[model samples]
Target: MTVQKTEWPDSLWRSTAEPLRDFPELQEDIETDLLIIGAGYTGLSTALHAADAIEQIVILDQAQPGWGCSGRNGGQVHGQWKPDLAALQRLYPGSQFDAFIKTLGDAVELVFDLVDQHQIDCQAQRAGSIIAGKGGKAVRYLTEWSKFWAETGADVRLLDKHASTDLIGTSHYDRSMFDRRGGSVQPLAYCQGLARACHERGVTIHGDSRAVRISQNGNSWRVFTAHGSVKCERLVLATNGYTDELWPGLAQTIVPVASMLTATAPLPDAVVSTLLPQRQPVAEYAGVPAYYRVDETNRLVFGWRGTVSGEIGSLNTAHLRSRAVRLFPQIA
Candidate 1:
């Protein structure tokens, strides 16, 4: 059950200059205390946290580590829950939502702490994040959201139209909210760092390994691949959007979405000094929000939501570039 290989994007931070490399394929049978299916952020973080406690741990990836979204994210490490506070309060009510929010905040701290402790060197910056407003309705929404976040002990400030223009150096946004809890990262490097840490902790990482067939053998489960099979007591399905065909109906509830990004040649230091001078990342509140950031080399990397066809193979870079120019006409 060999899987076709796909070329990963050449990340500025994860290319040859970086010290991490892809792991070898699984050639022999293996047994472990825990087996992690995906090598993305969630799976890698889980493995890293449990590495000290678990003696035998195995991480398997159909592709390589950081090949998926873990390497290809906007890298905005925002400490906010997926479901909004209102929705969480409505569903779980009272302390449940509060506890969830607190947990998410703690997770954000844990990510930074891990990076500092491991010395990941992923160009992590603790600047902040800006949610820019496009109109009057946007202003109202940001104001309300800022109030909600403030209640949760978040350091969020609502910037008026004038203040927003002054802060972002553009009149495109009518207002904005600044949240200090979020930051940017070189996502690919971060994932590679996690892989290295896992390896150092004696975690067996197998790349280019695809699980073609999975079956329950009485009390134990068998995960079959082309070269070998893993018979384990427990199995974790951590393949987010890429969990297709491996397990039937496993991703039925998740609507896989695609996003497109484009990077320009390294910008001049003068341009970087003037634009996003504070090194903070910016994202809009449009139906399809656009995110932009400056990499360590000062290159402008931007991306947006792509067409939703249940799957994404190739991305439309041209469209994303056009949007980038629209946002920062000076760069055009």
Candidate 2:
């Protein structure tokens, strides 16, 4: 479907986000030195970083910047990915693995650095993030993970059972790992702020400019949209999960997975003050689905594995709400 007919999922991020900064639709054919597809965090960050270095840059999105996962993420920015370090090492050389490990820390730093450097009003809080582990395996992995990072000079530590439960306000997890370098942001707001920053830095960003086709045109590449087209010397495609038939086999490179999030009504100050006392985001590794956080407004949000069927909330809200109450009897 075209952007005009796209249906955006109803989300707390959307409900709470400030008005989105506007970007014009591509109305006329243009040429640029660089063209970026997808205005999500990657594309926006890429454009922002290259604005001064590259003379001309254009960015296009199907709907709007932050309209996808970048805006709807759990907003828990932690320094870990593909948690199996051994598997990663098995796949990459030692040097490559080391570089990758360093990249994780660099990633967290980059997020906050961008926020600070641009003064992005995205409700950023650098309080830190916690991963609460449940069973023995989860606990051990988290413990070792924390130790590994701590050994690398990161401000990370593992909390014992009592500390984990006390900090989480629940006696469910056996332990928790805390990394001071991690934090959360108003994800949608952050995406919007990034888009605005890129625009102000002389990058051309267009919403509703879905790329329908990409073809070579002489020495450059041409992108055709419903309303306009862009010719650029180089093209960067950052359309991850929502990748489509823009270029041959590009969509197959990524799998489309979905996660669902729910937010409670903002709790009273008394309740929020007691919960997440340090304001760190908390995620649980004990159950089927687990990441939770306190947004800038002190609303409790929980996420779980979601279905592409688009009925997770309709099907599971009751259970999720019950779990929420279970997590914090303060709500009940």
Candidate 3:
């Protein structure tokens, strides 16, 4: 039997994202104060923020800008990380838990502020978000989680089963935590819009210029691309999930896991009214987590964890849709 190569899934973001000016390939050696590798959210945001102080900032991407994980994410503007207060308390005790929690709340504000300041047209919605608790055990945990935030003056609240069912259009969940600052956006469009903003601020971004190698050259570091190179005082490797052996033991630190999502054709208004009516993004908290949102054009996009190399639209991998249908039978 011959080994057949599977084609990669086409991205929904690329189809909906605003047109971005194509960046030219880097062709010659260049010198800059800071060299940022990977022109996704991290790299672009770095260059944008450093523009006011740093005179020479350069960004290089292996592919087109924002063509990585930043463009492929669910676009939920969430504020918390995986670690809860209990976990942080266990890890840091009295040292950094408060600061960490503060940062978590501050992050959502920072993201929305950036979007407002730049006037990015990425179909952004600030209608809020919800984390639904699946099963009775998860619902108990959800109540505890909500209380943890509520006691700290967070605007979060615990929604009862009735409230959650009405809001999420599903009876599968009995509890949920509602966050006012939560929302969703066009992920690729937002990244593309940010690229434009960064470019306008004099950040030089080069596409199709993958960093082949990096090394210390005199007092500065040299980041080498296939056709070009950059000499800079500081080098930032922001190659997210695509990170490789460029820095020894760096990639191993992050446990890489793959996520897959499927989008339905634009649902009718009558149908959308029954699901995500207020446009709040909903994430299910259980083993093998899943999340979904009402994206632009009223398309209900759903996602879940899966194999790294599985093909999209495959029957074996289409469990997400089946699960989604089970949650909201009205979706049919």
Candidate 4:
């Protein structure tokens, strides 16, 4: 896979995120108790958790923190797995399933807790999440989905057509499941905040220090980069979708899919007043896969699958624009 450059991409998140402090490139050979490759959420979160236990920890990334999917993703903090409750019960079995469900439910709360504890200013909002649907099939699925979560003490409700229309400012969806547990955030800012917390906790982070190779060195593992090498008793590979050949078969284990997003300029007051006035993040299962949420500036950021090549142009974003227009013609 081609490595991304050190420069950040032209994204709505990058344009709005708070400036991140620069980390130096690794230059000299070093040794640490733990070495994490990748500065995204996984790596940063791990480093933060391990800081109190481990004496020495180092994080290495090819680019600045939050320069990949962690920063570029849709900032929807939603819970619940893809499988339904029945399937999960069969898969996990008895008390294991209950523990799993509790974990899933607490996951969203954990995000807010971290934000409060670390004081991350990523525009964290707990307004709620709406999964809109249409037709009888969607209605049946969402009804069951809402019941499954509500039984576990989730603040969720099923909205009828009239209620869904009033909440979403569109009549496209006749039914929707609203859960108070989910919300939105400025993804890049959140990542930056995590990095800041890790930095303040004395977790050494090196940008532009891509791990090129890894090998077992007796009882320890040594990782090689362009300029330096690190030897650590514990090593973590947190490179998510950007996984490369550094670990041989690691990249092949997961298929990477490209996603694209486009944001409209801040809308007129009249349009903003009616378009997602509640400031809820929304996902639609009734049509093509799409998710959208309004930002602090009132721009509606819409996202969907992109081309396999990951190219961005008018041709690629036309669908996103059309969907937005269809939902709220007043914007056009």
Note each model's CA RMSD in angstroms: 2.6, 2.5, 4.2, 3.0
**Model 2, position 123: C-alpha lDDT score:** 82
The digit string of per-residue lDDT tens for model 1 on 1-332 reads: 55456467776545623765667777777776777899988888888878777777788898888888888877777665334446677987888876877886787688788889888878888887888868776777788878988887789888887887777767889888888877888888888888888888888888888777888878777787778878777677789888887788887867766776667888887676757777778888776678788877888888787556644554577777877777677777
Candidate 1, 84: how far from true, in Å?
5.4
Candidate 4: tens digits of C-alpha lDDT, residues 1-332:
34344887888899899898678889889999999999998999899989989989999999989998889988988875656567788999989988988887787887888788899999999999898888887888788989887887779998999999999899998799999889988999999999999989989999988899999979999999888899999999999989989999998886655677788999888889998898898887643467898888999888876444545433357778998899888878
Model 3 — which ten-residue stretch has the worst lDDT?
1-10
lDDT tens digits, residues 96-197, model 3? 878878887888887787789999999989988899877877777678878888888888889998999899988888898898877888988889888998
The prediction achieving the highest lDDT against the true structure is 4
What is candidate 2's TM-score against the reference? 0.93
Write the candidate numbers in order of decreasing lDDT.
Answer: 4, 2, 3, 1
> Which residue runs of candidate 1 sit more than 4 Å off their true CA positions?
1-6, 11-13, 16-19, 81-85, 307-315
Q: For model 4, where is the 10-residue window of minimal lDDT?
A: 306-315
What's the TM-score of each model vs. the native?
0.91, 0.93, 0.93, 0.93
Model 3 deviation from the true structure expressed as Cα RMSD, one decimal place: 4.2
Task: Please list all clashing residue pairs in model 4, or write none if there are none.
Answer: none
CA lDDT of each prediction against the hidden true structure: 0.78, 0.83, 0.82, 0.86
Evaluated against the true structure, the overall lDDT of model 3 is 0.82
Least accurate stretch of 10 residues (summed lDDT) in model 2?
306-315
